[model samples]
Target: MAPTTDPATTDLDRVIGFTIPGRHARGRVARLGPVLHAILSAHAYPPVIERLLAESLTLTALLGTTLKNAEGQMTLQAQTEKGIVSLMVCDYKDGELRGYVKFDAERLARLGKNPSLHALFNKGYLAITFDQVTTKERYQGIVPLDGETIAQAAESYFLQSEQIPSVVRLGVRRDAQGMLIAGGIFLQHLPEGEVGRERLHVRLDHPEWQHVEAMGATMGADELADPALPLETLVWRLFNEEPEVRLLGGTSLARGCRCDATYIQQVLTKFPETERAEMADENGVISVDCAFCSTKFPIALADFVPDAL
Candidate 1:
């Protein structure tokens, strides 16, 4: 049963996490669900690649919710030589969410049967970018892929780049029906001095923090890829016991690319006049494909002309 949403209901199918001891306190556990899965399935991807992309998508969405601003987009990108490179970007516009990914078919085919992230991407870097569309500037942080798995790499990224201690566990699996399922949980220690020291220090001393005690749950690809699991059940089974868990309300997720014909025309116009003229034929048409969604956009020579010119 899929989780349903009602404005009056306190419980809705969505990612939920909260800081303990009030607004000033730190520490949180964010969860992801259907909304994220929907966004990841926009493209037809091999099983292993799809799972990795899903995990990245969920992480990006969780971060989007945690880091709210007036108008911005959050991006998670990884550069890999295995031909399995990927990038997920989520835009937050009036609480609506949209995202997409790009992968190499040849590499995806080779890695489809292998479920190991380390095996697929022997060496790479995970990067996070926050772009405030309303403003011209953007903030980005990148870290080396230090861990063997996606979760570990992400955890390392958060700890090293953000300077916030965090544990991120992401899982993707399929069910009997072959639906894709992806879920993730993130736990972070409140920054020091943000909350009272005595209580914060005591909690940090707990055994879970001594070592990575969090375990990522195995979700059948079908379950994650499927459009049906009740969001409440998913969260309850995964993180209900964590004392600090808080439901922050759910956000809708979908697969979408912002590329269009006008953008393609703009790109082609950037080429040197000689190069542009050489590539153009008597008909003066240019065809461009979106790198992320693979959608083709065609522009006419007239469209490339500057209005001022």
Candidate 2:
């Protein structure tokens, strides 16, 4: 089917944060347009991989926006024993994100179209890492890839590790012209006593939480992927019955990369002289490609020489 071209979604690339103040529920809605296309178009990825990458990017955006104290970067990574798709990583810091997939193209091709998540990444484990730039401290969680989708894996992460009741849904589809569009929404029930301030815990027995989960499940692909459906409209449609729900606000997102000549040079300097020499081409220039943005940078060997050396 041709993708819907709702004017509301057109050119929209932002994450909207919302809250059910009375019910102690908070969530985020993210819709990506040009930003998503630009990232996927950089490489000739298969339709399956395209969809998977879109889901990862959307999930990263959702997680990044909801974080309160994160200063550096958060990464979601998965590796499988099947070798069809060995690794997938999505990195989010601030409001910017970049991700890439490492897969066995030949093996993936043989699996046929629309393979199951397990078929793509059999016996895999999913890991989430938080790198705090200011404190130079790292925290991470690893979970077995038990669900049918990445969203399910993420939901499990919150429930099993963080003890937070969370729900996440991600959608990615191609329009008639083959341009990709994606959207994601996340809902988590706040802890008791205080909404956002209480200790992390799960209370699935809460009546309101059940109602919210049911409403969120009704979200259709068109509703999420359609550019014409404004973020407010989506929230309203999902929880109109709950008048206390509040639309907090939103923030913009874009395709961004931190890789540059300076950063690349610093990395190469750590390599021994023999390794650096081996990396250079005939012109004595080292070439490195940023897998996230697919940007290529070339640096002269002299640039890596330390002044004190």
The TM-score values for the models, in the order shown, are 0.72, 0.89
Q: What is the lDDT of candidate 1?
A: 0.57
TM-score attained by model 2: 0.89
Task: Give a tens-digit lDDT track for model 2, residues 1-309.
Answer: 233455453646789999997667888899887777778877789999998989889998888776555477888899986758899988888778788998999988898778877888998998988887888888898988878888888899888777787889888876666668889899998766665654444332677777778788888777787776788888988888786877777878878778888898888888888888899999999899988878889988887664355
Error of 2 at 248 (Å): 1.8
Output the number of the TM-score-best candidate. 2
132-154 per-residue lDDT for model 1 (tens digits): 77776788899987776777887
lDDT of 1 at 15: 58
